[model samples]
Target: MKVAVVLNPIAGGGRLKRHWPEVAASLKRHFGDFELRETQAEGDAERLALDLAAIGFELVIAAGGDGTASEVADGLLKAFRESGRT
Candidate 1:
């Protein structure tokens, strides 16, 4: 399945950024294809997540802190609800 990883650039004090190569490698092992999106600003993650969900991505993974995760989840949930599949 296709997996989209939404990562916040400022997350974990840039720890995620440092480990992105390793993370992407690990994700490739589990998914046939994947996409990575780095948040450009505070709300970018949520917007990207929502767009992905709206476009029918089966999985949207958030790679960030709780706040970022919550934003992505909210976006996904909103998309799901709007699509009437929840």
Candidate 2:
């Protein structure tokens, strides 16, 4: 399946970026296709998640701390609810 990994570039003080390669490699092994999106600024993660949902991506993975995950989930859930897809 296609997976969109919405990463918070500033998360963990940019430590997340260092581990991205391993994360992407692991995802690639399980998913047919995968894409990475780095957050440019505040709220970017949620915006990216919403955009991914609008583009018909069934699975959007959020990789970050609690705050980042919450933002991504909120955005994805909003999109899912608006689309009436549960």
Q: Best lDDT goes to which candidate?
A: 1
| TM-score of each candidate structure, all chains considered together | 0.93, 0.89
lDDT of each: 0.88, 0.84
- Candidate 2 error regions (>4 Å): none
Candidate 1: residue pairs that collide = none
| lDDT value, residue 17 of candidate 1 | 88
User: What are the runs in model 1 whose C-alpha is more than 4 Å off?
Assistant: none
lDDT of 1 by residue, 1-86 (tens): 66799999778999988998898898888886888888888888889999998887889999999989999998998898899887
Candidate 1: deviation at residue 66, Å?
0.7
